[model samples]
Target chain A: MKNIVIGQYIPGKGLFYRMDPRTKIISVITLMIAIFLLGSIPQLLVAFSVCAVMMWVGNIPVKRVIRGMKPLIILLLFTFFFQIFFNKEGKLLLDEVMHVTVVSVLGIVLWTIIWRLLARIGKFKTVLLLAYIMGIFVLFRFLPFGYSFTTFRFAIYEKGIEMSIFVIIRLVIIISLSTVLTLTTKPTDLTQGLESLMRPLKIIGIRSEDFALIISISLRYIPTILDEAFKIMAAQASRGADFAEGKLKDKVKQVISLLVPMFIIAFKRSEDLADAMESRNFVPGKPRTRIHELRFGWTDIGVGVFTLAALALTIVLKVIG
Target chain B: MSYIEVKDLSFSYTGKRMILKDISLSIEKGEWVAILGHNGSGKSTLAKAMVGLLEPNQGTIAYDGVVLTNDTAYDIRKKVGIVFQNPDNQFVGVTVRDDIAFGMENLMVPQKQMLEMIDFYSEKVGMKDFLDKEPSTLSGGQKQRVAIAGILAMQTQVIIFDEATSMLDPYARRDLIEYIQKLNQEGITVIMITHDINEAMYANRLVILKDGTIFSDGDKWSLFKQPEIFENSHLELPFSLKLAAALDDSLPEEKAVKDFLWQSISNT
Candidate 1:
């Protein structure tokens, strides 16, 4: 009945939940911004290390955190493919197809190393999780690790330094921090924070209350929708519906059978909500009472000031560079 | 004055097939009423119409001498909050606390008072620990408890449970019924629509609707004098009541069929 698992939360008295939802939101955005603004190797090194430490503090499971990157697998390949021939230093994996720019032996080595480092520690940090996915990789068969592009194109040895372990440690930080914010704070508080953050947009007649309603409703119902889908899949599976062995066209028809029950449940839920709301005399108005109070305190200010100082120092370092 | 006066009410889903056909029911204030019939028997439609969620095609519904319409329905609604059949459908907030807070937020209660009320009602329904948890993760009974907490926090004068305990297991259902009984004792008017005849046994008034019309309406004790009522109305006697008939040969018991059955069965 009510016991439905959507995105399961790990109950913990960790620092993540102890922090206010608004504070968590602000810190997440700030850290993400810092990760993007960083350019130099030392800055990336520092930023990535900080993320690593935060991940360790949050106590999130490392593999589960890494597995979150399953969707971004294609993006990594695109990064590799785009930079490969253009590096113009590594051994040519293949001759330029239809006059595509050719890679020298040195190009591939530098591209691999730089891509591995940046994509793992960079804004979209999924490479740390996917380091071991062995598809048909375009390896530089002629470049050496210590040698630069200038030296590698003319060389013949296939020696290379393995991708670093620090990258996974780096990713564990980003995903763990994400879990810190989302898994600990309830969705209502998350929207309350967003509503407060977007208060300036109210001048344009975009009411945060209405926006919060949309968010809370979706947050509340999407899991139910997914659960409904799962239930239908199980029900049909029990009924000997041939979802598993069917051809593509037959499978599509089988999946469509699920749409009927899902929509019925959805409409029924909506109707019930409307009835409950009407009975409660629910009216749209100002001065709404929230169960959880979103507070800003000394700790929030301290966290904010610390992050602000980091931002300022990052700017200064960038200027010096 | 009739607490709820429905006069010549008629309705259809798409203007073709009428769900309620010129039905009229007068439920006096402080009355605990059970609207009962098989599925698609217009019992739920009447409940919806009573709360102003559904517009009857004809006639009028008035509460405490005030007509129920969109213009005045808002005020009437404050006096009535419904607990739906499926515990899942009525819950609307992200967390148990937030879900209960939805109606309060809509009602626009002050923040401090809202927090107090949330704590009070959550504890009232024994969901004090689940305030921070999502509704999806709670058991069906707990979800219904949260749903009850939400309506209870609203403090409406009339509460309708539309098969609200169907999803709950037996033990939780008993507890929920006891909760409702306590609310009714506190002078809150409760209306329940149920197919479960046992649930109806607990109601003060049972209004049997057969094919969009009231087949029988009266106190629960007196209604069972005619055993044939259930035969024609698509209802069966509660298991307790049926068991009471089986024990008629052995010992003296209350004339109330359900009580007799339960007593005789338990005495054994």
Candidate 2:
């Protein structure tokens, strides 16, 4: 849970980090639009390069950006597999008759056992995964022995490969653009920026200040609430509640034990917090000053205009294509 | 007139059971008072009532002669600040600096002055270096200090610590006690609410509460004289006070026993 980097802010002093959070937010959104507008390979290359340059200029390490995408890797792989296998269009690239015979089945079982045994060795995980995928395909294609039970045809097309690559690249571009925003801006600043951007909604009687306050408070308490939840789980575990090793019915009961205490603690905390806030003279919906006031600077203006122009150019190129 | 006066105050959450019953107390400017009680003794309710967080069912609380009501509560809050027991719950700001700024912001302090006060008060609480650090990353003691810094930045005349040190370790609690003593010495009226009698001993005046009423209230020495009150409240005397009591009982005179103990210490 700690490794989840979506809202994590890495403190740094750089051009992108110093820009007003609103500008950074706008830039991220603009780039995301540009990424989707991109149609051809060259356009995608341009979008990817822009994100790379933004990461570099922001002093965000390439490794950190990749780390942020770790959880989505499985989803990306699934999408890739689904797109290539399901979509049959354009020129055919591969057509093979794969046999599911006894030897092939035995080979797959042996490969699975070896993969499970070596899975705990973290350094060889990528190599082992690649082998695990390729070895199954190899066994299905070449190893035909005993009595053949089934034969299935495997095929791949040029468009399938092309669309899969495009989809993966597009997702990466969007994720990296947003990752740059979260990594550069503080959580407080992000909420403040959102409030600032949503100020125009005041005409419709929407209170953005209150909304931002809610978000910021939630962000501030997420870790604390999570810590309390884990503590409750531990306490329940000590009292003969097995949250992990339980039947579905028993698991629900165990989870209820955890949830009841958590809800009680959360309510108690909010009550205390309200009292404390009142003691501090915080009147809801009232005007309040801020310590770190956000003001646009030259860099913010420069980035804002640059992103707008880039977005315009992308739209133009899309129309032309 | 007293700095704060609570008269004939009674309160209850459900109205079925009275949490505080006819509680009347007064604190003077620059006085260090400790309100001590065991669990569910209504000590915390009394503190909250004084700060106008909870209204009394029967009587009035006046700060500097102005009565505390719903309308005046917001105004009175500017002069009084409270640090709650749970540090994580009361922390409203994302960073230490913002936490200190929270109160001042609510009172509409200017941005420049707010920054200056954040720096000055954070330094006073020894949290100057941690101004930008998140509250979650901070230790329990550090969060309390940040809370104190926030209250101090608001420049409140009266600061209430409602069992603030209860969640801290012994070392952190002692450090905080020393800091609170220093703050009281510097003329901030300090009202410390705690279940630990030893912690209450640091204050000049001690008020022991039992069963929703003030069981005993007096100067420290006077409360020490009434050992039965401590026993009734399930509070133990500090080791030094206990040793002094033993010596006074065994020896001929209290002064003679103190002199003997001082002489042995000086000889060593």
Highest DockQ against the true fold, candidate: 2
| Number of the predicted model whose lDDT against the real structure is largest | 2
DockQ, all candidates in order? 0.55, 0.63
**How far in Å is the alpha carbon of B254 misplaced in model 1?**
16
Error of 2 at A202 (Å): 4.6
Could you give candidate 1's per-residue lDDT for residues A1-321 as a string of tens digits? Answer: 356544535556765666677788888877766655655445667776676676677665556555655454465454444444244543444442111123434454556576677776666555443442321133433323453344233222111101122333334445555755666666567788888788788888778877987787877888778888888899888988866797999988887798888888888888777767657776664556666667777767877787788778777776786
Error of 2 at B134 (Å): 2.8
List where candidate 2 sits over 4 angstroms from the true fold.
Answer: A1-6, A100-110, A124-127, A143-152, A201-206, A222-263, B222-255, B258-268
Task: Please provide, for model 1 over B147-242, each residue's C-alpha lDDT reduced to its tens digit, 9 standing for 90 to 100.
Answer: 878877877878888888988899989988888888888888989999988888778789898888778888876787677888799799876656
Task: Please report the candidate that would top TM-score against the real structure.
Answer: 2
Candidate 1 chain A, run of 10 with poorest lDDT: A154-163
